[model samples]
Target: MTVATHPLVARARLLADDLLAPHAERVDQAGVPVSHVEAVKRSGLLGVGAPAEYGGAAAPAAVARRTAEILAGACCSTWFVTTQHYTPVKLLAASGLPVRERLLRPLASGELLAGIAYAHVRAFPRVPVRAVPERGGWRFDGTVPWYTGWGLNDVMLLAGVTDAAEVVFAFAEAREQPGLRPSPPMRLAALTASRTVSLRLEGLWLPGKAVVLRTPQKEFAVVDRPRNTNASPAVFGVADAALALLDGVPEAEETARSLRTRLDETRERAYALWDHPVPHERIEERLALKTRSYDLMRAATTAAVVAGGGRSLDLDSRAQRLFREGMFLLVQGQTAEVRRAHLGHLGD
Candidate 1:
């Protein structure tokens, strides 16, 4: 079957059309409800990239990316919450560690949703969170400044840096516990429905069996840098959704067609680099395409707002939502390198 016809992709489309899109505005204003998350879990889209033996579809990367686009376009807030599940699944699938046997199946099968607390690891020398060796396990102390899907997720893959400069990733129940305290969710300009909060890890301890992956900071950066260089599929998804707003406006027909062509071209180049066999090669090219995608996303979302006229300023406006979401995407997974490159591109 074609990627479009893939079961997981088709399920994503159905979920997007029937549920996510219809309630996106409501969810945006009211915060994403537990029911919306339950619908996603039942749809089985959670296991798109997981191993088949673990009750997952084990679909190709193309299928996974396509599903992400559909969901993000339909409701970026919902997409953001669910998107955190994939990383833990991926790490566990590749790991021979004891944690793999324990959490992989449940996560891959959508029986358990996982959130991530590892992005702060990107700070490197600044190390906001620290992991110190303890009694046959580890002790994590410090703060996770940004943790999304807090109350909604069943577990979290938390990370902290050791004095040896090793990045330690481990699993813990995502809850208020003995040593883990979560701050109230922050109100943001976009995707506030995602339930984002800060985590304080004061002597939070996990057994060695809970550990997933531990790698040297430099080695981790080697893999992580390339991944961040690629354009996020969500960018195209939100852009396409915004362009559709223009397509429906009679006076914006020419503008819609012109922008669609540019978007398609940029998307093709970005994905080609994303799928390249050698991820580490063409680093600059990847960053260039990524920034280009961001530019197009901004333009498309802006056009949508302009076409929307004064109504676009309303809280329920899809155009306004997409525009704010686009703004959020600009800094979503930003790294020093990405920021420098994007700013440099803007300067040029």
Candidate 2:
């Protein structure tokens, strides 16, 4: 089936139009509610990229990206919370470890929602969390500077660096356990509804059965760098949403159309590269397209705010929320390489 007609894509559209978009502004201000998350779980979106055998759809990558765009465009806050589930689902699907059998089915079926605490692993040489072999398992100590969907997620795929220069990823309940303490949710310029917090991992221990993937730091970076270089579909989604806000503003019609044209062209080019067989083949081109997407996202959100005038500053204004969310996306999933490339692009 075409990506547009894919059942998952249709469900995402239905979720966006009937529920997410209608309450987006409220969700932004009040935080994503449990009801919204329940709806998502019931919608079967949590398993989009999971293996079909595990009660998942295992849809194509294009379909997955399209669904993300739809949800993010409709309600970025809800999208942020649910988006965390995909990583754990993906990792478990690829793993041969015991945890795979235990968690993959529940995760893939949307019966359990998982969050991720591994972004800190990107720091490499300065590991924020450490996993030392101990007691037939491993001990994790140090801090996870950021953990999103704290109260909402059922489990977390936590990661840490070992002295042997390897990255160890494991699963644990996402709660205040003996050694995993979480700070209160952070207040942010955007997506505060996602319930983000810092995790203090003081001697947190997990059995070997909980471990999923263990790979050399360098090897992990090799796979990770290319993925980060590609533009996120959510960027295009949010940009499009911002551009749509200009529809009612007659004075901004010309500007909106021009930005839309540029957005469409950039999105086309970005997706073309996304579909390239060799992910690592065109590194520079990927980074360039990513930065370009960011540029378009910024311009679109800013134009939305400008077109809204002072009313956009209101807490309930969709334009203002998109503006803040745009700021948040600028740094989401950012790595040192991405930062350097983006800054260099800006300077150029």
Candidate 3:
């Protein structure tokens, strides 16, 4: 579907313009205001991937990606916070568990927003979090180095590795509880308004019904590699936003257009490889495209900063924000293997 016709695209764009863009600088310094999140919930974009049966849009992947691009380009912090909801929605839809029936409707309807603490699953051998069998449930013990949307999210999808090297994910109350303690929201160089914190899980327990997915570590990695290798649409979104800042400057405008064209071409190819049903095929090619996209993103944001001159150094300026955002995108989905391949591309 065309971006204009897509159910959530127009709404996302409206939110980006009316809410996200206006308060972006304030949010950057003060943290995402609850009112902004309320706006997002009221907009109904949260359910872009939810099943239609539950009053969700359930739009196609391409439409979802475009909507994400719009939101990310408009305001990365808002995008980062709300985007966490989609993963749990997808996980619940795939689980076929009773919890899906209980949670999916409200989550889709925006009655409850969800955040994720499962990225630590990628730290398998390191065992960042460990899950132990307990009475009628599992006890999770460890530290979550990065947990975003702390005060805002109603529920979280938390995962820990078991002794048998299986990863177990369970739904938990997002607020502080006896075993779940969140550090004061961190002061970060970027996306600080997303309200990220380090979570210390001290024997946190969730009953059997709370558990969502449990599988061998090897099996999990098999599924994760392809997903992580794909280029994030946000990278292009941020770059596009930066290029727009250069539009009034004639010299930079021409350069920005060239970079934008190359960015779009590489984005198309990267998404093609990402959507390929065969996960591992053309992996090196995917990494190459991803690296190429990063290069363009850097160039685009740098151009915007250069064009903005003295004003660009202001913390509240759009140019500076986009540049900082570009730095974040570089490591957003990075894995060691992806990092190595990306570095190799730089040498070429």
Candidate 4:
């Protein structure tokens, strides 16, 4: 379907394609893509998850999915970074009425750049962080490493354990807070345009206003819904990128057809749970399908690598970037191990 049929997604595709195609080499060489960030902000896309009340489109999961897919076709890293913005804000919007006013408005308007810092590299940070009581609020003294897009984000939905709660979002700014120690941006395989950094919170403080969830041991918002839809567009985008590569290969039309069917199968199954969280059986089945898709991404990248040869290894080759970025699928968490876990948990 044409993006114009859904203006927001259409716009997302156009910008992603433009920046990703022309600037892929530049982004890889320079590391990080500040220029595209500016373009994204200007396109009103930064506000994708803000409530309509705050002048945002406040689009649904479907639109978000389409936008991601379009962007992924050109640059998976950019697409990954792009998805981080809205879903987290959507989480903020769900934090009862108080949070919506305090953080949602500026965030939706692109007046703020924000990110989620929950992955601790040991797995997900499924805790409220260390929230010792303080005046009017609690102090957050901990670190969430591998926080992607730190440099551009003005706010962060920091998750931590506060003596209660399984997961919650903390609204934090890039302030000179005593407890919050931020590192210079780190290097990575892709999406380097974002300011990924290690955040050490010694005495980094937060006001009650910044703490979005205070309920102990309870999930403040629903991540299951959006996270599912959020992945499809990008996965599809990778497929699109793969197809593009295949078109240049010998018997490329046959390769394209074979790949497209697998891609379509993936899209259908991924979207099957759009209206619901993936059931245990479906999740396991998808673990296999998703693993297959990851393999496809590598295979496609290999084609680019083969076609490109040594030039692909050059400092200015799109093939190398594709190869590096395509490798993300390998770790995308859709392997047999995860499938077995899901399968084992089927009856539990």
Q: In candidate 3, what are the lDDT values of residues 223-303, reduced to their tens digit? A: 888877888889989988998998879878679879989998998898888778898788888888888889999999999
- Which 10 consecutive positions of candidate 1 have the poorest summed lDDT? 246-255
Report the lDDT of model 1 for residue 132.
97
lDDT of candidate 4 over 35-121, digit per residue (tens): 677677777787765788887887776676677677766766665665667756776777774767877787787777677775441
Q: What TM-score does prediction 2 earn?
A: 0.98
Q: What is the lDDT of residue 171 in candidate 3?
A: 95
Instruction: Please report the candidate that would top TM-score against the real structure.
Output: 1
Judged by whole-model lDDT over C-alpha atoms, candidate 3 comes out at 0.88
Model 2 clash count equals: 0
The TM-score values for the models, in the order shown, are 0.99, 0.98, 0.97, 0.84
Full ranking by lDDT: 1, 2, 3, 4
Q: Candidate 2, residue 271: CA error in Å? A: 1.5
Candidate 2's residue-wise lDDT over 92-183, tens digit each?
Answer: 99998889999999999999999999999888799999999999999999999999998899999999999999999999998899988999
lDDT of the candidates, in the order given:
0.93, 0.93, 0.88, 0.64
Candidate scoring better on lDDT of 1 and 2: 1
Candidate order, TM-score descending = 1, 2, 3, 4
Q: Can you write out model 1's per-residue Cα lDDT over 175-222, one digit (the tens) per residue? A: 999999999999999989999999998999999999999999999999
Better of 1 and 3 by TM-score: 1
Higher-ranked by TM-score: 1 or 2: 1
Model 4 residue 122 CA deviation in Å: 8.0
